[model samples]
Target: MNNSAQKPGLRERKRRETLQRITDTGLKLFLSQGYEETTLDAIAEASGISRRTFFYYFKSKEEILLAWQSGTGAAIAAAIQEQTADKAPIDAVLDAILSLASQFDANELVAIERLLRSTEELRASKHAKYVQQEGAVFEALCAKWPQARRRDSLRLIAMASMGALRLAVDRWVEEGTKRPLAKHLRETFESLKAELGRQS
Candidate 1:
């Protein structure tokens, strides 16, 4: 019985490693040759995996680019729950977003942003994914604040916070600035708060 459980666990670990290898190789190729120019076959060849195997891991090249963020929505939701136990709902969500942003390297994020800007298909797919994640975050926020009955308001707040973070990172990357992502993120949050205060 234990062996049966262990078999599945080991298989899953190996599968995750294979998928990561494919994604890392694909990103490198995409960054070098442009996302559209880098084919799935090239990614498979670079990762030493068959094209069929690559398909088993990801349905398309765009899927591979956004795969990390797929399951991450749920993780973000959970992080918000844990981190915001005693904090205000919006503050908790902002903290979670900042924490999540810290998970990736600055170069990796700049590369991903560049790919999204250059690829219309990826932009559409990424937008859809962001909408889905926004829904998840909204649900989590509602759970945290039972009186927060306005879903649209929560979503707008989430979107605004995300937009601020994206702008900060984009500026940082464009200027070749070297700063911790968390610091940029905190500054973005502070700027948003200040802007809101000015309007009020």
Candidate 2:
């Protein structure tokens, strides 16, 4: 795998900037005209990049959506690792997820979620990307607990925590309520924790 950081040069920075511009332009267009209606040529033209350059950054229309999640996954994993270094692995994982959830603007996320729900292809792509992200989070936890044998348990806990956050966000979108996303996410996690404690 090519490490973007180690590939130092002016050209690399220019390439990154171009990719960002293309992605930003494509997202804006997708939001304005539904994702299905937006064309790659229009995105390339809007971003002032050639069609070839656009293809260099992303292979297809669906790939742009995947790219956003992939880019954010790395940041989320790092945030979790940094914030949860001193805590129990499960607590750390939940805290990390909550932190990532807080970064989203509710309206923007609701729109994106609506777009994702509207297409089977997008739903599959998003789910696959999330599975990959879950693996990354699992790896980060394993790094922190190399000798721990309960890997499946930890993964299940992480998935459940993430699922709760997802459901909360979905409810917020569905209700069109004015509550902050972080509050809902935290409440969901807390409720899950209480339920688990009761079962035990």
Candidate 3:
């Protein structure tokens, strides 16, 4: 409903920065004290923002955990929408995902993986945020495809593409940064394509 849900400097870069601060602080506390042990007041205090200010950026502690993925997921959705209409939907989606991975620091990602595995709540939060992220990407793809092509086929492909990206990240973290993350993402996307083809 609110276009504020859309991102980047259309307005309030300050807001995004504040959200990041809250997210970083919240994540650190979650990792250190355990998610269930951490309180919102502690997070707000750690972020150096008032409790009211914290609520202005996010509704609850869960929203703080979702914040990091939300920002990156928005960017990935925008990238997919930027692709030319000539490309196939799968190519457009996976290429956008790969490009995003190119900008990522593999070491930093591994650190996040460690953080996510730190608590049961964090692990569950990771999966929940991913579902939200996929919904965002799927909506972007829905906007880009031709009306005639925007059927079950497109939705299925979008779901599968998100699944491929998730698997790519899983393998990337598990592999201990032996190779570039972008390469791993691309490879996973290709593997997904082949598997889908086989089922077709």
lDDT of 2 at 134: 75
How well is each residue in 52-162 modelled by candidate 1, as lDDT tens digits?
A: 999998999888778756656777787787774677556787788777777877787777777876767877877787777777787777677656466667677767765
Q: In candidate 2, how many clashes are counted?
A: 0
The sequence of per-residue lDDT tens digits that candidate 3 reaches over residues 83-120 is: 98899889999888877877866666677677777778
Best by lDDT: 3
Candidate 3 lands at a TM-score of 0.79
Clashes by residue pair, model 3: none
- Per-model TM against the reference: 0.74, 0.85, 0.79
Of the two candidates 2 and 3, the one with more favorable lDDT, higher being better, is: 3
If the candidates were sorted by their lDDT against the true structure, best first, what order would they fall in?
A: 3, 2, 1
| Alpha carbon lDDT of each predicted model | 0.77, 0.77, 0.82
RMSD of each: 3.9, 3.2, 4.2
Q: Arrange candidates, best TM-score first.
A: 2, 3, 1
Model 3: per-residue Cα lDDT at residue 96: 88
Clashes of each: 0, 0, 0
Candidate 2 weakest ten by summed lDDT: 83-92
